[model samples]
Target: MNKIDYKSPIGLIEIEGSAEAVRSILFVERDEIVNTIHHETPEVLVDCLNQLDEYFRGERHVFTFPYHFEGTDFQQTVWNALTTIPYAETGSYKDIAVSIKNEKAVRAVGTANGKNKLSIVIPCHRIIGANGKLTGYAGGLWRKEWLLQHERTFNK
Candidate 1:
């Protein structure tokens, strides 16, 4: 897999995959967040950096890049539904299941949300808990709060 890194106010972001798709976008681990980008990065990372800059700067809300992910059919369905969630708008896990027409799959939706490797680019942070409380976020609850708050502060 092709891997690349770039700097962000949030930290060093690692983008991985080929031109046909971006497979993952994640912050370096918390311990590595502040670490300088150490790997030799791919030239293909330029688009990732551009899109990410726009995202953080609030000039862009929706991503135009093509992405490829590996997951079960159900996980893919849930992730696609996540993209439909408007930036700056919060949805519940139940909301996601309803949108996917699988109200009984709320737990599965939550599981998929946790498995989201593309992270903020896929906008999983938009999902809240049943009672609107923040729930499981693989990137860490504080980062999740920061991302959702960032979008609300600057969403177009």
Candidate 2:
């Protein structure tokens, strides 16, 4: 995967990935590729760029590209639950734990959300505090709010 740069409203994004799939996407002030697994072009990367563009424009609410994120089994379980969060809907850490049949794993659910690598594609923004307050996010809370607002504005 080679590093790629994407211009977004917030800033330029740096993502690492291979020809078959994307591994990660990071926002930065300038071009800085890291941990890229360079792969064939016009295939995996082409679709990634297209979806990313649509997402930034609020024209896309879901992603359908192939990704290869690595994580612990528990983390993957929590991340999988995140995908079930409706496009513009929100959920609590407790809600996730219940969905996964681990009703007592609220703290673990929060940890899983904190470790999510797919970011917007996984819709981690939809997760909030139990009281509905915005909580942790790898992308920063401001970005989370922005994403949720972006979804709400277009989802209707």
Candidate 3:
């Protein structure tokens, strides 16, 4: 897959995919290196970066790029449910589980959420604790908070 490291407001974001679809969008620390790097940003990745720019600027709420879901069937189901979540709205793990017709899988839902590879586009940050508090995020809670707040502020 072709990859590009984009510097977003939160930090460096690694975008991975091929010319067809985006596979992942991950926040990276300073000096972090991914497995493979692409010298030229593919056409699909250019759209990804542009949309991300609009997202950070609060000019875009919904993402339209194609995505490659590379995970287990359950994980893919959970990820698809995540896309149904409206921008700037929050959902608990229980909510996700219930939406998937497995209300008892709250913990499992959270685990699946934790495994989401794409960040802002897939919108894992929109999921919160049952108590309405922020929870675990691969990009760290601060970035998650920033993303949520960002969406809330510009969700017109």
All candidates' lDDT scores?
A: 0.81, 0.78, 0.89
TM-score of each: 0.88, 0.87, 0.93
lDDT of each residue in 1-156, candidate 1, tens digit only: 677666667667888877567788887764353322235444345577688889888888888777787899999999999999898999988998999888999888899988999978889989998788988787778888988899999965
Model 3: lowest-lDDT 10 consecutive positions: 31-40
TM-score of 2: 0.87
Q: Considering TM-score, where higher is better, how would the candidates rank from best to worst?
A: 3, 1, 2
The Cα RMSD in angstroms, rounded to one decimal, for candidate 2 relative to the true structure is 2.8
Clash pairs, candidate 1, are: none
Tens digits of lDDT, candidate 3, 55-150: 999999888888899999999999999998899999999999999999999999989999999998888999999899999999999999999999
Q: Is candidate 1 or candidate 2 better by lDDT?
A: 1
User: Which ten-residue region of model 2 has the weakest summed lDDT?
Assistant: 33-42
lDDT score at residue 75, model 3, on the 0-100 scale: 95
